[model samples]
Target: MLLLFLLVLFTQNYFSHGDLIADTCKKTEYPRICVSTLRSNPDSKTADVKGLVRIILKAALGKANTILNQANDLLKKTKDRLVRQSLNVCVSVYEEALDEIPEASVNVGTNNFEANIEASATIDIADDCEESFSNSPFTADNNAVKQLAVVAVDIIASLG
Candidate 1:
């Protein structure tokens, strides 16, 4: 069963009827301003496809780090143990999300699927973080969790 699911996912990602990879590459241009500032100069290290993927990875990582830092900072400011615990989970999720990229790169290669992989990683990280936050010590504080959720959503949106 697991193998079947894996096969389905791989096929859907790489050989779907639609060219989601190309579409995602096109969307990467939307964050050119953010990418330029966050990554190295826009010099032609490679073709636009690879260059754009690099930019997307850089920008997504930057956004993820920023969100994680904000959560940590907020936790530090608050003495509430629940908030601190939730923030710790958020931190862990961000770390795992960041950690997955290198492996994903190896799996998908740098030339293609980079943007798609980054987006998928961001979504996974956000979902995991949100789930962890909601069920932990901070279950009562929906408002703060909502704010963190907004940050995750913004990070995903910014990537596009």
Candidate 2:
């Protein structure tokens, strides 16, 4: 029974989601990222537009959380006061983002979905964190979250 359910679920996502995912992604700024990210999630197989936003937001939140953890770890290990100050700023900004993503996710299903401000805010948050350092902190992690947030903005705008 478990195997049967798994097989059925796999086929359902494989066949049904292709066109929907492609169609939706076409309306976004980052079509490739949008398509690949949505297709990678099993829940997205049956999810509509709003559901896709939630998935993207959740992924962004996860990435931000990881970046925060990394920053915190680096903060404890580094001796430079300047780097420490920058890491502190990144940690604060990321925490702000961490709070916002959940609210954005909840707002997805509510009347405020379109009114939510995270579309540009997420990008700003990532950019702000990046700019805090002289050289740049969490290079790869910062880029990843920024890209995810960009994808989120495109798709979230489509919701409007």
lDDT of 1 by residue, 1-160 (tens): 9999999988875444224334433344333343333235344233243443444444456556665777778777989787677788778877875665444443333323443554466556765566765454323332232332233233344444
Global lDDT for candidate 2?
A: 0.80
What TM-score, over all chains together, does every model reach?
A: 0.48, 0.84
Q: Which candidate is the best by lDDT?
A: 2
Worst 10 residues of 2 by lDDT: 111-120
Instruction: Please report, in order, the local distance difference test score of every candidate based on alpha carbons.
Output: 0.50, 0.80
The deviation in Å at residue 24 for candidate 1 is 5.8
Q: Give candidate 1's TM-score.
A: 0.48
Q: In model 2, which regions exceed 4 Å deviation?
A: 1-16, 112-115
